[model samples]
Target: MVVRTFGISVLVTIASLVVAFIYGSWEAVALCAILGVLEVSLSFDNAVINATVLEKMSEFWQKMFLTVGIIIAVFGMRLLFPLVVVWVTAGLNPVQAFDLALNPPAEGSGQESYEQILTDAHPQIAAFGGMFLFMLFLNFILAERETKWLSWFEKPLATIGKLDQLAVIIAGLSLTLVAEFLADDQHRATIMIAGVLGMITYIAVDGLGSLFHTEQLEEDHERDVASRAAGGPSTLVKATGKAAFFLFLYLEVLDASFSFDGVIGAFAITADPIIIALGLGFIGAMFVRSITVYLVRQGTLSDYRYLEHGAHWAIGALSVILFISIEYHINEIITGLVGVAFIGAAFLSSVVANRREERSDGDSTPKSGGGESPSEMATATD
Candidate 1:
């Protein structure tokens, strides 16, 4: 199972490194390797979140995610998206933007390089990606769930979630405050517009998925009831057709939100778009996708219980970091470490919880001649 999951990523990593070496020299190879590791470290939470959504998708869509989705992620987000951002922000034509990326302005030339242009556009990017991720985190925490990892915090939030569009209200206020205080006069309006657009994008994509998913649930329930009456085995109701399409779209947008930081952060390592695409797009993305599949196939999220919670909380922290990054330069190392800390802490908590449950079950079990009580045995079996 491990090899089946990671074989492609391994092959791609080797190919990417070879390409990097051929493209430049051993220095390029080293930089590519470093960037690949950086992307994987920064995106572990992204893998966890992707697993939650991918597990619901049909096999065909899952295949598409690994195939067509990878293409989009590699070229579209890693390569073309940065070019497009440079074009829009710097008022350059397509050829000019592409040329600028390929032939960056020399340092001390008093001209803006591709990296500088992208960095200058950070306010807008931060506002957009930050709000999108913030909405995702808000929706996850605000929804009432059977399992709560941080009950002390999540319980009160869930209670307040009874108010309609409370997430939107809070997000709106947060965006307003950031725009007012963090953004300067020149970019204030841009940040506000971008943030609102981010909110709208999240609502549209997530709302469509929920609408179709609710219908799918009703249909599955009917099918399950009919199957039970006929005494046949019931099958899992995975999302397919239009429902899967929307979910796939949602996943891509989510990936884009996650990639915004990685793409920008890559400039700190290298200005070459080719290297970034090879390292981040090919190598990092493949492994992240593999990890997502492995988690789904292994039922890691179900077994750990709080793994998903940790991922979402990490996302919440990343969103805040993005907003903070607009005004201050945040080191990528800090962002990566914060996510790892959350996931590690949650994994430890899950281990402790599992042991406690086991002990409780052992204590409640019948001993000696009593054997096992039928009800207790049934509960244990479940």
Candidate 2:
């Protein structure tokens, strides 16, 4: 299953290496490889979070994630999304933007390259992505869940989540604080507008999912259907198509928020759009998708119960970092490591929990096979 899941990633990595080697030197190849690894490490938490949601989706929708979804991640976010950003932010035609990207201006030129222009547009991007991700984390933390990893923090938040629109209010306040940090009126306005749009996108996507909620059949009918499916008569569980569509949209947006850092950081390594797309887009995104599938198929979350909690916490951290980055330059490596640390700690905790459970189960089990204890047998006879 691991081989099958990573098959595309393996192929893409080899292809990226070969292309990099042919295009320049071994140094280029190494850089591409590093970028791919960087992307994976940075977004591992995103993969785990994605799996938690994807597990709720139908198999058809799951398949769509790999097929249609990968295309959007690769082309839409990696390739065309940047072009769109340049076109919109710089007020240039798409063709001109594309050319500028492919052939950026020299360092000595007074005019900035497409990469620099995009970097200059970072405030707006960060606002939009940050707000969206902030709300995502807020909603998760605030909402009531049967399970929790950090009870001290989560318990209070869940209680606070009961207040209507608390998440939105907090997000708005966060934007206000960010606005205060910025000196430029225009940049502040841009950030405010983009952040508002991000919040709206979340509300719209979430509301759309609720609006498309399908009524389930009666319990008797569900039981019969489940029995038939389990008995190998019926084949599949039907999923609500409209709900799936909204979920898919949510996944795409979430993915974009995660990709903003990767896309921008790619310029730090190389300004070549093609290489970024091939390494980060193709190889990195494919591996993320595969990781999501693996988690769902293996029921990893159930086994590692706190993993979801940790991923959300990592997301919250990332969101804060994104917002903070607008005013200060934070290293991409730091951001990635923060996520890694949160998820890694959660994984270690889960391992400890599993071992504890095993010990408890072993202690409770009967020593002899198919036999009652002497005490039990004597009591029964009495």
Residue pairs in collision within model 2: none
In Å, residue 217's CA in model 2 sits off its true spot by: 7.9
Which ranges in model 2 have alpha carbons more than 4 Å from their true place?
Answer: 214-238, 366-382
| lDDT for each candidate structure | 0.93, 0.87
- Tens digits of per-residue lDDT for model 1 on 152-182? 9999999999899999999999999999989
What digit string (tens of lDDT, one per residue) describes model 2 on residues 126-212?
Answer: 999999999999999999998888888899999989999999999999999998775267698889999999999989997787566
**Which stretches in model 1 have alpha-carbon errors above 4 Å?**
370-382
Model 2 lDDT, residue 93, Cα = 85
Clashes of each: 0, 0
User: How high is the lDDT of residue 65 in model 1?
Assistant: 89
